[model samples]
Structures are given as structure tokens and as C-alpha cells.
Target: MINKIRLAIRNDLEASAETRQFGSGWISGFLALVASIAGLLLLLSQRYPQWFSMKELALIHNQTIFSFVIQSILVIAFLLALINLVLRRNKILGFSAITLVFASLLIGQLIDPQEQYIANAYALGFDWFVLNLLLTGLLFIPLEKLFGRLTDQPLFRSEWREDLFYFLISSVLVQIISFLSLSPSMFILETTGSWSGFRLLVAEQPLVLQVLEIMLLTDFVQYWFHRLFHEIPFLWRFHAVHHSAQKMDWLAGSRMHIVEIVGLRGLTIIPMFVLGFNQQALSIYILLVYLNATFVHANLRFNVEWLKPFIVTPRFHHWHHGIEKEAINVNYSIHFPWLDKLFGTYYMPPHQWPKGYGIGGHPVPNGYWKQFLYPFQKKKKTK
Candidate 1:
């Protein structure tokens, strides 16, 4: 049954978007599948909070509103699936979605919201995954459809599953990633306890000023690290996985090597952590980073030439992923385009996008696990 569901999705993904007409039931069926899966995942997290829920997200899901949301989603999924079954000759998507919704309903009966268990050494971040997916997908999907740079590009573009998998693992392992990324900063703070007076002074500054300072500091650190990954051969092996994306979309940025993720977070966050930015400032900065990262990588068609000199835009970052010869080793800054201009690495052709994306020869193999092990594998010689 599981294999059947997987095959159904794979088939749908491979199907041409042109064939999936409005009244043909494909859209409703696909949405039904998503709703069912999301509903089930949230229900599982509620049932086994210790293993599937993040402690930080407790407040977000604890309210009665969340319960109402889950119920509404399940109901919507069931109705959509029924509509698909009535309209389409293929029953696969409809049947599969309905089955999952039924499974979620059965498990919902066993859930005890009051029951609590202490979290073990490790737990999945299901709550985080669901929320992240809902928020980003909701915001970007419609915008992309309406104003995408590549207007014809389908939602399930080539290699989308791989990027989505990257999104899944990164979110589900958020706890592990956060701990690994933040431990060094935590240690530095403890060891430099004498610097508390200085840190306190920095933290006492206006919240707006602190956030601006954080943006500059973190961008400066990330700029050099970003260049090093491109220049250093060993590091390029891992970073190449990110560049291997042939298509640019909101989800494409999620295709990063885990090693790079940890290293970047660990190194760039030192100033924010050790310098004692207040918790509120740090939180706001984190939120900004999340939104900015998504925005820069999104497939939007907005004209932002006015802001190009001061800030990074989709066209600016797309050049970094361009496979053209001149595109090599340029545009290393993430937030401030001026950093690249100052360091003489800036290259953005006025009113022009990349001819194509991905590595020149496409050395990096496809899929998540393959790319994960790619950096460790020895490269083959070609005469």
C-alpha cells in the first residue's frame, strides 16, 4: 500500500502540467493528498509530543485554534478527494489521500492531549516542519504562479522532490542542527564570562540599532565563508550540491549540504551570541534571515533594480548559481550587495538573468543522500 502511494505520487510528478487541467481533478487531488499528509503529521505530533514536537513551539500549538485547524484540514481533504473521485478516471490520488485521512482519524481517537512524556536525547521536529511548510508554501506558491520569473515552470518542477526532501530533513532535525550550531557560541559566552559588562552595554542599545548591527556583522562573516566555499576545492565538493540546482524557486535554497549548514550557522552566529544581543533582537534577526533567504531564492519577477546597489535580490543571487564562465567566483554577499562591490566580486548585468543554472559539467549527482556522501567520495579523472 505504501509503495502504491509512492508510485502514484511519482507518476503524478512525472506527468506533464499541461495535461492536468482545471476540471480534470489533478489539482484537487494533489491538494487533498497534501492536506491529508499535513493533518496526519500534526496529529502524530500531538499524540507523541515528546518525540515529534519542539518545546519552543508548544505555545503555537497549545491553543484550541490549532485543534480546530486540524479538524478543518481533514474535512477539506476528504471533500476534495471525493470531488477527484467523481471527476477523474484515475482513482489513485483520491483513494490514497482518503486512506491517509482515515488513518489520521483512527489515530486521532487514541490521542491524549493531556498526556506528557519527557523528551529523550533526540526527537523529530514535526511541528516545526508542518508550520514551516504551511507558512512558506502558502505564501510562495500563489505568488510564483502569478508572477514567477519562469511563468511556465510547474510547481513540481524537475528535482523538486529532492529539494523538498532537503526541506524535510532540515526541519525534522532542527533540534540537532540548532544544538550543533549554537554549542560553540554558548561555550564562548561561558568562557568569556568577564566580557559580560561589555556584552551588556551592547545589548542595552536600541533594539532597532542592534538588529542593524547584527545584519552587518553576520553578513560580513558569511561573505568570506561564502567565497571560501567557492575557491576551496574540498569545500566546493559540498557547496556544489547547492549550485547543482538547474532551476531556481523558493524551495531550491533548501538544497544545502548539512556540513555547510552547521558550519555556516556555527561561524556566523558567534557575534550575535557572544556579543550579547538581547533575546528579542536575536529572535527578530533569525526571523529576518529566514524570510530573506526565501525571498532571495524565490522565482519572482519583481523589478528591484533600485535596490540592487544596496541589497541582494533574486537576480543577484541567481548570478551566483549561473553556469556561465564569467559567473564564476562573483557575488558572494548574501544581504549587502555592496560587500561584493567593495571586495571586487560583484557582477550583475543590468536587466538580465542567467542563461542557465547548475554546474558546468553537472559533477554532483542527484538526490539527497547521494549529495550528502558526494563530498567524501573521490572524484574520477577524465583524460
Candidate 2:
């Protein structure tokens, strides 16, 4: 049994390794394997919601049929890929693929699925989790393929699993983060978002102006917090987890220390509380931040040339991640580059990109838990 577990882990490692080179055949096989596992696990997730998050499942349209179709298509794809891999004598991948099927079957039998859906307020919706994974993969995977700036960077880049763990944790604990981040502020401020005076002022402004005001106010607060993370040695340890991604991609941004996430978000929203932005305006800003942050971290090369000065683009942010000494401590603005320019920290080189990414000498330990605990670990004493 021990040997079998070892073999399974070994094959998965081999399959993961092979995915980095990403040959057409390997890509198809890998996709098939992933689809199968995702599909089956999703099916089983209904029976065992505790195994993974499904909080958003209730929100999906035509949940049951949609799931069945997703699973069926993926299972078919997996079988085809399995046949292809087996014929080609790709044992490691074949082993991994087959293992997923068996494990899914075993788990399905073990769990007694409910006769009807029981809505638990706090249940992790596996359906939601699976759908989120599928949507992001489908959306960004294609974009990275067709328009990547770092063209040679593979779908399965180094430390992908580590970052993936971070992604999963953040997504699963999303509500928790919201509660935690907002709770302290809510407690202290106790300012009902209805400051009638500020609300009237906000109402008087054009909708566009309200949005611009919130963006400006929020970005101003975030800029200083972002800079604090960089400038303070203690905070740098936490922020460095984000910079540890040697390769930048859509998933890279999710690799944040929980402290940084909670602290930054908690603090950023203070202005919102004080200024009393309308619910609609706040919602718009949240939506914009969600998409913009992801786009800035993505592998795609496309950045609007004209907007580089006024807005934050992938190029604008990638330079911030650059390992180059000159680029370090530069480009601290999250939304507008003009803040960086205003602060005298802006350092964009004309007609050039960073030679590489990540901290120069400080290498972060790979994996979620290690990095999470790293900020608190004592520094090694060198005699």
C-alpha cells in the first residue's frame, strides 16, 4: 500500500513535469486527465461537499444538467487521451489517469449521496469551486496561449502547485476573508455607510465622477499600503510571497500572505467607510479591481500603448515584479502610474522589459504552508 502511494505520487510528479514542455500530444493528454478528474470529483463533490468548496453552486444556472454535461464531456475526453497515452507507452501519465478514475469510483461508493439538496449556509460548494476552476482555465488558458508575452512559459510552470494551493485556499475562504477583513473596520468605525452629508455630496456628483472619486481615493490608500509592504522589512517578508512567483501569470496574484491580504483590504476599505460611497459605486469598483488585478498579473503581452501613462497595464506591473535592482522599489502604484510618477518612484524604461522576475538573492521556499509560516521564522545565524 505504501509503495502504491509512492508510485502514484511519483507518476503525478512525472506527469506534472511533462506538462511543462507541453507537446501537443502531452497537452491533450494532460487536459483529458484534468477534465476527467475535475468532472468526476465534481460529481462526487455533491455527495461529499466537505471534501471541497461549492459555495457558489446554488448560483450556477441549470446546475444538475450543466454538471452532467461537463462531466460527460470531460470523461469522454479522458478516455480518448487514455487510449492515446497507453498506445504510446506513456506509463506515468497513463498510471495517473487511471488512478483518477479508480479513486473517483472508490470515493463515490463510500459516500451516501443525499436524496435531495440540503442547503447548508456554510457548506463549501464543490460545484462552485469546479465551475470557477473551469471558467478561469477556459478563459485565461486560451488567452495565455494566443497572446502571451512570455511565450515560452508553460501552462504548468515551476511551483504551479504551490500557487494553485494558494488559489484554492483563497477561493475557499473567500467569504471568511471578507468577514475577517471587514469585521474590525466595521467594529471600530460603526459608521453606517449612510453618512447623509457625504451621501448627498456623492449623489450630487455625476455617476462617472463618483466612480473616479472612489478609484482615486482607494488607489491613494492602497498605494501607500503597497509601498509599506515594500519598504518595511517585517512587512516585506509577507509581501515577498507575492513576488516569489518567478513566472508571472493569471494565477500568480493569488499567492499572497493572508496578513497582507487582510491588512491591505481592511485598511483600504476604511476610506470607503469614511467617505460613504454609494453601494452601486462601491460594487463597480470591486468588480473593476477584480478584473484589473487579474489582467495585470496575466501572461498576456497586450497593453494599451496610450494608456501606459494613465493606467496600470501588464507591462507597467511586470516591471514592478522585475528582479533588476534598478526596477526594485519602483512602480508602486496599483491603478495609475501617475502616482508613481508623482511619488518619484516611477521607473519605466523606454522600449524595454525586465530581464527577469523575483527577488534577487532571497528564494522563497516552495509550497503554501511553508511560505505562510516563513514570515515568522527566525533568520538563520551564520557564524
Compare the candidates by TM-score and give the number of the best one: 1
Best by lDDT: 1
| TM-score, cand. 1 vs. native | 0.95
Model 2 stretches astray by more than 4 angstroms: 1-24, 49-51, 54-56, 59-63, 101-125, 193-197, 200-210, 272-283, 379-383
Backbone clash count for every predicted candidate, in the order shown: 0, 6
Tens digits of lDDT, candidate 2, 1-383: 86886555445544544443444355555666766667675766666554444544643323567556655755665685676475544544555666676676666568755555544545554555556677777888899989998887877677677777787777666656777788766875565645667657866777777788888988898999999888887888888889888889988888899989989899888776556677788888887887788888899887668888999988889899998988788888878999999999998887678888888875678878889998897643110
Q: Model 1, range 51-96, lDDT digits (tens) per residue?
A: 8877676545557887888899999999999998998777678888
- The lDDT, on a scale of 0 to 1, for candidate 1 is 0.88
Cα error of candidate 1 at position 358, Å: 0.5
Cα deviation of 6, candidate 2, in Å:
7.4
